[model samples]
Target: MLHCPRTVARTIVYSGIFLATGVSTVLAADPTGDWKVADGVANIRVAQCSGNMWGVVAWEKTPGGKDKNNPDTAKQSRPTLGMPILIDMKKKPGVDAWEGEVYNAKDGQLYSSTIKPVGADQLEIQGCVLGFLCGGETWTRVGPPIPSSPSNSMAKGAPKAAPGAPPKTAAPAAPPKTTGAVNPAPAPKAAPGQKQAAGQPADIGDICLLPDIARFAH
Candidate 1:
């Protein structure tokens, strides 16, 4: 956690524009960890994967919510529990910034995103259009990465267990029937998550990442 004054997160909501306050900066080191959104309602876990960084909705206080604005019809009501909102981010050469894409669950649009680490804890994450229109928050680090249980770590194709942590066993499979098995059938193709054809939105986003920042203040 960042060592700073207990301040409330307030936004200058000026005709679809947002400016985040409360500033303190330091060397922007590795931004791969759990970060508390400005409003403190959700925790985003950022990690390095496959030579790129990815962020997911690690935990949310929003109860039983689904992606209501997803453009994909088939995935409209998908749960946000473990969704990847920030994908395929690469660190910029010689800068404390990472460039990538951010998925806005509110409008179902993917905006070009960049994250610049201020201090060791604060991160300025802005998602925007071609170059100018943008919105973002100064996220504070919420300690280290949320420790993944052995089972969950393994399930995610990794065994990033903590030091001295024990390995967990997978759930048992169902027993085979004492009869001839039927042949498997092919499944239908999946829908596209995003579009390639381009044209950006005039406003990137309206949702304040952590609208209720005070609720999660330490």
Candidate 2:
């Protein structure tokens, strides 16, 4: 997610300290939300999917950008939107930070990375090449933190239709059996800013259900 070159030797000193101090924070800090990158070139939407943290490109300052620099020839023409930048980050035991690999689309390389929340509004990202040559930047929160989705909810709730295919219609359900007791009415939709009840699926358009993330969610 960081566009800065990893060859900068000066960043190692500060980044080393940053990574070290990040471990002191208490656990249970949530990082799910939209974040504005340091350079303001793009915003990433982070969410919990299949019990791990993943971030995808949600918005770009300049539209219609392609992943031209990607190493995979077949994917070079693909649009950058919705691409996963944070690759399956898992929470570090007893710490608030996540450890994973970050895909640097600018250079078509993946680096070992860690993301840590700095207070409630800032996210610190650091990446290292060969376990050194570290560099990072802080991303500011763009919206309120999202409540963590139930584990694997995104995958389970993901639409079954293939991309560009027409959606399938479900058959109508049979009439309920006649009984003295009446069936309870369905639960009301969760109001905005309210936490969803446990086991409830996320919205169909949730970023965690995107193909790039959904395929790896399980």
Candidate 3:
């Protein structure tokens, strides 16, 4: 092959551009780590799973939390610690954004969600039940990552589910008993499918701050 000077120079320029683009893409779109949410009241571990990403609750401020608000009657028995909050996130090509579903423990609803990094250290996680009625929280990358909290063992072993198995939905807690210690944040009266504000709870302020309530109010 006859190497022309002009052709060689053009090839070098193109190769440099391609390398730079690849490097930037690699650096920009990874969200693998422990993320502090709810004003550091809760933390989740995000990791790659089945060609996507999932986040599970590693810790909560409130001890031995339960998902008292879940809609699934059967799931109310599970503890809130190992519940999957951020589900099946797929990265948007050429951007620092991911699309996923966010499970809100407050109302037991899963909203369409997106996670976008505002800078190197912070991520903006927004979820929307409807376009106008949406809210988000800022998550800070806490550290490289810690071992899955002892409480989160249910979701720690496998990154992805088995083939043909149903996807793992958010774990729910058992139905509340008439113990009088039912400390769930009250969901305000709304029409069907109308969700409460991202962080604000309903009218129940009498209860103490349990893990359930601490992460609800914005």
Clash count per candidate: 3, 0, 10
Model 3 misplacement above 4 A: 1-25, 145-218
lDDT of 2 by residue, 136-216 (tens): 999998755655534345445565658799855745975332111112223334457655445332222366657787677
Residue 43's C-alpha lDDT in candidate 2? 73
lDDT (Cα, tens digit) per residue for candidate 1, span 1-218: 34333222222244223222222222246676667788876657665553455676655654355888898888778766556777677889988788999888879989999988776778788999887688888888764532222221122333345988886674498433211111122211223663322232111111112222111110
lDDT (0 to 1) per candidate: 0.56, 0.72, 0.61
Highest lDDT model number? 2
**Candidate 2 deviation (Cα RMSD):** 17.9
Residue pair clashes in candidate 3:
62-211, 75-172, 75-173, 76-173, 76-174, 77-173, 77-174, 186-202, 199-217, 199-218
What tens digits encode model 3's per-residue C-alpha lDDT throughout 6-55? 89999999999999988666544457566678576666656544345567
Q: Which predicted model would earn the best TM-score?
A: 2
- Residue 20 lDDT in candidate 2: 69
Please give the ranking of all candidate structures by TM-score, highest first, separated by commas.
2, 3, 1
- Superposition TM-score, candidate 1 onto the true structure: 0.54
